[model samples]
Target: MSTSIRSIKSLVPLLDRVLVQRIKAEAKTASGIFLPESTVKDLNEAKVLAVGPGGLDREGKRVPMGVQAGDRVLIPTFGGSPVKVGEDEYQLFRDSDILAKINE
Candidate 1:
């Protein structure tokens, strides 16, 4: 059976902010050994799904966000506020919370 898609319209982020949903690590390791969540690595990486408009600078000019939706990113282990969306979970934080973006 197929599941219906639910809109994320209500998940608008604030200025200079974005929302991300973490990607779960695979069950098996590089060596192909299956592992559980407890044994798996604590990967805090996520993919950007929604982004806010540019934030106002000291001069009231809009400072554009460096990252955009659909970009894969790494977040600090101690950053962002966790939120639950339906049965899924996501994190909301300021643009500064993004540690780095993955390339390739």
Candidate 2:
């Protein structure tokens, strides 16, 4: 099973939302301890890849999603649906799963 998969640009979720590829955990801890992959859960930071068409407003207009592809965002730890991309685990959630937009 290969974890290396192609880009996620193919999946454009509905309602002006999208999927993101969570970033990997940092290798070092605050105390400078190196951690292995098995010790970590899902990493919180992610980059948006795919987005949906804007949601419809009561006035019959499209309300655009707040975030776009390539945006770095902070995701809630408890949010989102888990999915398998290739051989690795990824998450599928609406734009709401994102807690904050990372400036960097």
Candidate 3:
């Protein structure tokens, strides 16, 4: 593994937050044609790297998290906190902010 990935995994989120790595948009089309950077649109898909412990509920009970580490999920287009680990960039989102867990 690269040093950056190892470095990033060292960070553990706390209190219902999740750490994820955004899946990059394809730079090439299905036809094998290379596209310019300007033409590439960012994808909302991400891979869960680490997740915090479940958050507390209003009744003081522990709420289970919707997603777990290593799950593929769809994230919102905006509003996640940006994080940089070594040379890689990751995003931190609330477990609730994750749109959905991808079946694939």
Best by lDDT: 3
Judged by whole-model lDDT over C-alpha atoms, candidate 1 comes out at 0.81
Using all chains and alpha carbons, the TM-scores for the candidates as numbered come to 0.82, 0.74, 0.88
Ranking by TM-score: 3, 1, 2
**CA-lDDT, candidates in order:** 0.81, 0.74, 0.90
RMSD to the hidden true structure, all candidates: 4.6, 3.5, 3.5
Looking at model 2, report the run of 10 residues with the lowest lDDT sum. Answer: 1-10
Query: 64, model 2: CA deviation in Å?
Result: 1.4
**Model 2: how far is 70 from its true place, Å?**
0.3
Mind giving the per-residue lDDT tens digits that candidate 2 earns over 1-104?
23344654445578856677789877779999988878866668888877777778899898878888888988888767665656656666676567899998
Error of 3 at 99 (Å): 0.9
Give the alpha carbon lDDT tens digit for every residue of 18-103 in model 1: 88888789989899999876876768789999989968999998789878999999888886877775567788778877989998
Ranking by lDDT: 3, 1, 2
